[model samples]
Target: MWNVPSLEEKEPELVREVEWFRLYTWTHFSPSDTCRTYGSGVVQPFNGSAFYVRSNCAFILTHFTHNRVEYDITIRRGDNGLLSEVEIIINKVRTVLQNGSILVEKKSVSLPYDHTYQHVFRYGIYTRFKSSLLPLTVTWHDVPGGIDTLWVELEKEQNSDITGLCGKFNAEAEPKCPGDLVYQDKGPAYVPSCSNPNPRFIDQENTSSCVCPDGKVLNDRADGFHCVTVSSCSCVFNGRTYLTGETRSTRCQSCLCKDGRWHCSENSCPPRCLIEGEFVTTFDGKQFAVPENVLVFWQSSMYVQVQTSFGMKIQVQVFPEIQLYITPPRNHSGVISGLCGNNNDDTTDDFTTSSGIIESSAKLFALSWSLGACSENIPNPCINTDNALKCPKNQEFSYNLLACNHTCRSLSGPDPRCNLQDAPVEGCGCPEGTHLNQENNCTPRSECECHHHGGATPPGPVVIDGQQW
Candidate 1:
């Protein structure tokens, strides 16, 4: 049978095995049993003897050096005035534990490296690892009680090479509490963070508090608190978080969140205009109806002119009334201007004059854009009070005279003149039984005007040069 090691024989080995040790326990008690509190403590071997120190405040729990490797451990309190976070730094790498989560450099990561050994216990996880520069095995147990237990087991040759809260290994000294207790009924300590970098503290109290490593900031996230450089932090917008290099777009602009701010650029949106019936919507989005009876008169001496350009025809009339009609092409949009208004879809500045001032009065605005001098006094032709010049007794007043008074004089088959219809003007026209003749009089269809070679003649016998024909 194999012989097992006896309890007495293993006692001395177990006592000398661990160079330093610490165990944090929950000390806060609640009478109502409605709130939870956390606590902290430390235990280490000093001069071949073990001692313990306990506290409920946040402070630098321990800072020691062993075999040229530095280890720093700190306890931090939360907003609830209870110990909540634990920070550990070995060499330059930092790790934090808060709210049952582990964070390394502001990001959650799996515990127990490839070289580290891990074990799961009934209460928590236990991890152990030994770095090349450190001549001791470092072990820590994550407990459910909001505190952790740490142990440093040294090699036999490195027994007297340790210093700090564990005590100077070469001297026999009594364990003492750290003088730097922090957050004893005090306000919070504001440090640099992703959301609030370069924080300015007011009424700073003389106390020790845990901070992120050099050149890093605290990133308080939904999961837990993290320590990271400013450049690696995500941006928060509209109550949502966006990673670096993410982008968003709107109707007029495109934006990206970078370096904790929004960078935006205007979008290139072409404008459009709408002119429907009496209502005109400009390129700048101003909407209004054209005023009634405000007529713009071109000089009567100017002959009729037709110009074809931009896939559309422009017809200028200067006979009974000065009128202009432009039939724009399907693709002709956003580039036209003048009396019709800029077709750029924005109506706010449609009445801009040649002098660059936007005029408010439509009549004055139209006058400002006229190329030639207009008659100072112009009469409204539609307001004819003379009953003799009005429609015949049998006729009725029609708003759309083009359809109601179409006669042989007005019908020129397949001609451009037939397509050039006038705008609807208030006028008198013949009723169903009669049509307007070339003599400017209403008559029955049997005595209507006659058309020969697109020329119109009155229905009665005509006398030309005093000869009856």
Candidate 2:
């Protein structure tokens, strides 16, 4: 008895797997003739010199010629109806017949978002078979787990290999048009008839072979190589039309494309608390980018730090409940924004500044404060001297500025409240002949009865020194 290997035991010298997906097609120049198909479709098998193979289950709607193809994939979110980043995979194959045997090689490429990819057989050696009839197969893989759609016939050019082959084989009286020559004895299996009621059955040739680098459609157009984006109409991107709230991004912000417009919001990242130039001699030997006149306080027990510029009048306190409290200036109208809380997971809060820098007060802080913070009045034990209580940024903290019967600094003279040395003496006072009122602005002083001995004085200029006016 003669021993023979089973069909399953001997693998074919050339084998290819092309995953089929739903595809849409069109037959006419108008948009009304659009057609669609969903499920596996087969391409006609090519009977070459030594081997014959058919692309099974994969949709073969058009002839794929050796040319650059372009298409776009539309990706959408599954949970919500929003568009998402798309990923595409292309499987490339190379086949050659040498030494009376067929050899096969495979490779792949991955792409993100909507992009066009080319499928050209210009491997120099492969071009040598310009006039010879050979068999080749191309496959593409779609990224899984996303809303994937392939828009075919958007802006594309479709060519048939018979036209190229005729030009090569018939060197004299070369065919100028596909109708000039005739081909026969082809199966309907490879004929793409989704859009056409009757398609001409011919040997499998390249027609519209290039699907979206990420989608599942093959189409041909006469208006040059173009593709319809999956998420766009006239406002299309890549190839598809996008609905409202489809998001795209740049370095600083995320932009949502909607109804022919783009709405963008800031995409902020946490700022690094770096102290440049000098390694921190204190606080874990870290580096920081400290601005001039800025003070940084690190509390070891609380494991928190505060960085404020000198004279800012802002106070930052961290309590046991992992809360950060920021007190802005007395007349605050500025914006204060920075990172806070633990290093691993810091929190952020923003407040309108009194000055252009950073500004607010305790009760007023509740007006527009963010980050879900509360107050516990935790005083800093490290600050013992009065100098540390000086105002921050653009503010003044007069100890008794609102107290009655206190000596007030005259507006006519330079403001002494700004001087940290005079903080102890700073008090609220009105100009001469005025008294402190509910409003901080000075008001006219009330007349009072005088009990001095009766004496009438007239307005006159008198000088005891010899120079009298």
Off by over 4 Å in 1: 1-42, 46-52, 56-69, 75-83, 115-125, 156-161, 169-469
lDDT of each: 0.48, 0.29
Per-residue lDDT tens digits of candidate 2, residues 1-469? 1121222332343122222211122332223211111122211212111111122211222233444432212122332221122222222333322222223332332221121323323332221111112232222222233212222221222344421100112212311212111222221223231123235555534332223323211122212222333233123344555455677664446777743445668546333332111113223223333554553432222223333343443322333234445544345455334332122222332333332232335344333344566564535546433334433232344434422232122222332223322112232234445532222334443322111123111224434335463
Candidate 2 — which residues are off by over 4 angstroms? Answer: 1-207, 211-298, 301-303, 306-469
* Model 1: residue 117 alpha-carbon error in angstroms: 14
RMSD of 2: 28.7
Global lDDT of model 1:
0.48
Worst 10 residues of 2 by lDDT: 43-52
Cα distance off (Å), candidate 1, residue 232: 61
lDDT per residue (tens digit) for residues 179-262 in model 1: 111111222245456778777767654222335667766664323345677777777765788877898774556778776667
lDDT of 1 at 83: 41
